[model samples]
Every structure is written in C-alpha cells, then in structure tokens.
Target: MTSTPQERLRLVGREEATPAAMSWVMSLDDSDSPRDIIDALGLAPFVSGEHPHALSAELERVKPDAALCPEDARILRTSDDESTKTVLAAGEGWMLRVLRRTNGTAMLHVSAVTEELARTVIEVCSKDATVAEEADDTQVSMGFWHSGAHGFSRRERTIGAATWPEIEQNYSGDISAALGRLMALRAEDVSGRLLLLHGPPGTGKTSALRALAREWAQWCQVDCVLDPEVLFSNPGYLMEVAIGVDTYDDSKRKWRLLVLEDCDELIRGSAKESTGQGLSRLLNLTDGMLGQGRDVLVAITTNENLSRLHPAVVRPGRCLAQLEVGRLSPAEATAWLDRELGDRPKPAVEAGGMTLAELIEARDHPTRIQAAPADTTAVGSYL
Candidate 1:
C-alpha cells in the first residue's frame, strides 16, 4: 500500500518538513500552479485564503507560534520606498506562510492536519484584524471601487476630512444653506435617490462631497467609483457595484452613497446618442427597477450647466437635491479672503468672482495671482 501525502507529512511533523517545503515554494515562479507546489511538498489538505487591506498590527498579533524559516524569507523591493515581505513559519502539525505588501494588502496560507484548525485560524485572524480598523469620529471610512482583471473589487480606507461645520463658510450663503439641509438628512428623511451637483470646475464640488461623507458617516457608507464610464457601460460591472453585499452589522442596514465624479459626458443632453446604454444604466441605478428596495444613493458631479444635462437625469421627483455649485460673489470672495489672508494683501477678484480654488491659490500666493495674465485659468479649473 502507498502512503498518502498527508500521512507522510504527519510522520515527519510539519516543523521538520517546513524547510524543504519552503525551498520548493521559493523555487516556483508566479506562473506555476499553487496546488502542484503543495502536492509536491506533501502539504495537501491545506487551506489558503487572502485578506485585502489587512492591518500590519493585527497581522503581527496573529502570526503563527512557530519557528521562522529565515533562509526562505523573500523581500521584494516594489519601489524605492516600498517593499513586500513574504515569510514562512511552521509548528508541530501546521505550516503558515504570510505575504504582506506595503500598501496594506496581505495573504495568508495555512496547512494543517485538520480542516477545522485551518478554518478557525483564518476566521479568527480576519475578524480580529477588521475589528482593529474601525474608525473614530474624527476619521471617515470610505470604500473605493475599481474594475480589475478579476472583476469589480472594493477596498476600504479611513481618511481624515473636515466636518461640515468647519468648511461651511467656504461656499456662498445660498449654496451653504442648500448643502446644510442635504447634510442633515437621515435615512428616513431621504425622499429621492439621487444627489446632483452641477457647476464649473474649481467651485469646491469635490470638497463639498468629502464634507458630506463625513456628515453622513454615521448612517451611510460612501463609495467612490473610480471609473464611472466603465461602471455604467458594462452591465456585469454595474451589477457588481449595485448589488454589493452589505457587510455591516445585521442590527441596522446601512445605506450606500455611490459617488461618480466628473461625469459630464455621461449625463449630458445627448448622452443617450453618445454613450449608448450608459445614461440609461445610470438612471436605472438611481430610481428605475434596478434601484427598487435597495438603499443606494447616486451622487454625481458634472461641469456642465443644468440645462445642458439630460432631461431624464434632472427630472423632478427623481433627485433628492440638485444644486448648482457656482463661484462666490464679489462680496463673499472679499470676506473669504479677509478671513484666510489675515495680514496679507488680497488679490483682485476676477470680474465673474473667484471660485474657492482661486481663493485658496490667491491666499497662498498673492504675488503670483497679481503677476499672472488675466486669461490664465485657475489651478483646478478643469477638475
């Protein structure tokens, strides 16, 4: 009778067999099959999984209690400042390998004699690692979605952003009032499913969105779609983002705010002719059959004027709020400059008044503003 790989592995003990297994794994290239490597190394019946956005501190806490194979450790210098580390360790009946990258992505592979041990270790590590990532009130947790070779994937990060109260004065009185009401909205207060902000670039549309994320951080999970065109055009990708699994606690279902920025072409008057099914898919995500019963809100920012946008997009009752984020008035600009540049000489405001970005640039470099040509556009004019 022939002895199986697992029976042979148990006879030698995992700790004794680890050095040889690590040597074999290190010899394999990225194109090699992982299962083949495991079988060749007598590590069958093993479980493997990956954890995205894994915290370094939590990984350090969950490292297997085993002897390290320093000789087989690999360090990949991804860039001048970033490096990826892969380490292998083994105990009496188990072998653990960890690959951690500088960007907070990590993968763990464990080979144990029993399936229960392998699953329990993975579950405990994932749960404990995520718990440590909960953000405090000062920071907002945001999810970013992108389409990769594997498909649409989401990664989360905690970012520090100014609260609505801190940046309320950055906008004109009318714009501020409109945004104040939008920011104060609770889940039950939501009437429509769309939030539209149309304006020229550099008027603080992106900044306002960030502040809105912080204000609604308690009841909403804000997710920014990196490629809105692909999201709307590809039905599969759209479905992945629209029907995302809610990973929050079951006690309360959290609403999702999907932010699509600089989507001028997708919602313009001729969008249907130019973008095909893109505009229709976006409408469906907001309030059409696709949006029924789903607690999802779509917020879009475009540089086009409200009149230039497609009628279907800005139709009444479809949007919760649609506000034009225009530049500040001459008087409002003067007040903002006075507050920002306390002792410095102020720059002359443009005839059409200055956008918030222009105000910031002027406050930071008053001399540059005075020397630049009158036709020169502001730094974020095309944002």
Candidate 2:
C-alpha cells in the first residue's frame, strides 16, 4: 500500500518540522470533476467564461504544478521520480516523491482528495500571494500591503490626475519616505498616516502624491480618491473608506492610503468661508470615530499657502507634517528646460529660477529662449 503525502509528513514528523527546512503543501479542488472551478472564483471573463475551453483549457495550457481531478473530486500531487519516493504507512495512506529545490528543502503537496475538499482547494489556489495566517480585526491595514501586494492590477491601467512620467520624477524620494512610514506603522502595528502636500501650484506636489501611489504599488496597495464630492455623494465610498471596506483586495482586508486630491478644494480656508459639504465630510473622514483603528494616508494637493489655511485643517498633530513645495530654483529650472528643449541653447536660470511649467511655456517661443537676461540692458533693439 502506497503511503500518501499526509502520511509521509507524519512519518517524517518532528524531523521534517525543523526550522531550517520547509515544504510546500498545495491543495487542489475535486468536488466538481470536468467542471471549470475557475468560474466559482469570479475570475475575469477573458480568462474563463469568455474562452471556448474555459478554465480546464487555460489550466492545461499553463501546466500548473498540480491540477484538480477531472473524474474524481480530488487533487493529484506530482514530483520528479528521480529522487526517493517516501511511503508512510498510516490511516488513509498515500505516496509522495519529493521535489528538491536549490535550497535543499524537500517540497511536498497534499490534498484532502475528496468531494468535500473543493472549496479549500479553490481558496488555497485563489490566494494571489501568501495569505496572512491571522491578523487583528481592530488593526488598520498596512499601506505597503495595500499599494504593492493588494491594490495594483496588472490588467488595468491606473488612472491618475498626473501623467506617469510626471509622477515618477516627482515622487522618487518622497514616495520612499511615505512607504517607509507605512512600513514603520505596520511594524509597530499602527495605522497609516495622512501626508499633507501643500504649497504653490506647479511645484510637483500633486505629481508626487500620484507617484507615491505607483511606487508604493511595489509593496503596498494605493488608491487615488479624485473629487471628494463624487466620493462622498455616493455615501458608500465614504462608508467604505471609513469602515475599512475600501480595501486594495480581499486578502489585504483594508485600505492603506486614501489619496484625496485637491483636498483644499474640499476643505480650504475657514469652514465658514468654504461652500460645500465635501470639506466637513473630509474632516470627518480623517478624524471621526469611524477613522479610528484604520491606517489612512491622505495626500492632499492645494494651491493655497499653508500659513493661510484654516487652523482646523492644517493644525499640528492633525496632518502630521506640512510638506512645502515651492517653485523650482534657477538651477532646477535650467535642468528641467534642458530636458524639454533638448539643445535649444540652454537658458541661464538660477535658484528660484523659472519653474518647469514656466520654462515649457517660455521655450515654445524661440525669441524668449534666446532672450538676453532681463537685466542685461537687452542689447538694445537699436543694434
């Protein structure tokens, strides 16, 4: 009688459980043979329902390590026969041929091999990545998990207020800091914090916020909340973000960052001076009772100066820190212009020089690009 993988684990017992060694255990669904179990998972139509052969064809096409049984509602585990095939004699026994990895750890997969194991198989397989064994219910989800592991989708292009290049160039360093903050929060079992980016227009604040989302997508899930009015109008969006229902994916279980663009538009100046329910709603979203136990990073973009913003909105301990993005200096401006003009006689720019936006605007006209320093007495048109 051939012993099964589960029996083998029992035979190997304490020895195989060594800290230095680990093995893989894959579960395959068997409840529905010849039936594409992919449909039950609610996968996109492009991969399952839309195709003629559906999941079976796709699974066979991909040739995953193990597959669901076509006739019996069971899973079949396989490995190379070159190595020793272990036989563990136990109740409901089976056989397993170990697969050796470079790390020298023996890998084995076992399934319940019964009609009842269908749901478990799909669950084990449906997991996009290693699912957490256990997490606190009261804890706010980590931002790194949200942006990188949960929120991002390879199939869908991210829609943001800024262009891809604009986002990358702007958030290179700032994104790193934001992600670091998120990781720290996760390490300390704390929730995400809001990042307030306030300054004059064209300073790359908005672009940085978007880039932070994309960069953080490598580890944390990030979602951009455009137009607070639309989000709060539905009430569901507000509820979702408030209740931790607005998550990157099912595995993550909660949101990491609630990117609120142009929050100033929603909460700017004195509350008495503003004209919408959006502002108060945003305030409630950030500090309200529902916000507790949730990790939320609110990246706000505003043209208004920080000093002038309403005390309630910009107060310390509320926003954490106010990042100021002033206009680019002359050196930064020249570098930016050089990139845009590509050999059109680089302009002499200094710190507090023409902003990138201004350089682009000015570079469009050849005369302005070659214009003498305004202080140079302009070589007089008389010459």
lDDT of 2 by residue, 304-376 (tens): 7776677667755667446766666655566567777787776677555654456656678645445555464
Query: Residue 257's C-alpha lDDT in candidate 1?
Result: 96
* Candidate maximizing TM-score: 1
* Clash count per candidate: 0, 25
After superposing candidate 2, which stretches have Cα over 4 Å from the reference? 1-156, 159-192, 244-255, 335-344, 348-352, 359-383
Q: What digit string (tens of lDDT, one per residue) describes model 1 on residues 313-374? A: 98889999999999999999999999988988988877788999999888777465345446
Error of 1 at 379 (Å): 34
Model 1 spans > 4 angstroms off: 1-99, 107-121, 127-131, 134-136, 366-383
lDDT of 1 at 359: 92
lDDT of each: 0.73, 0.44
Prediction 2 global C-alpha lDDT = 0.44
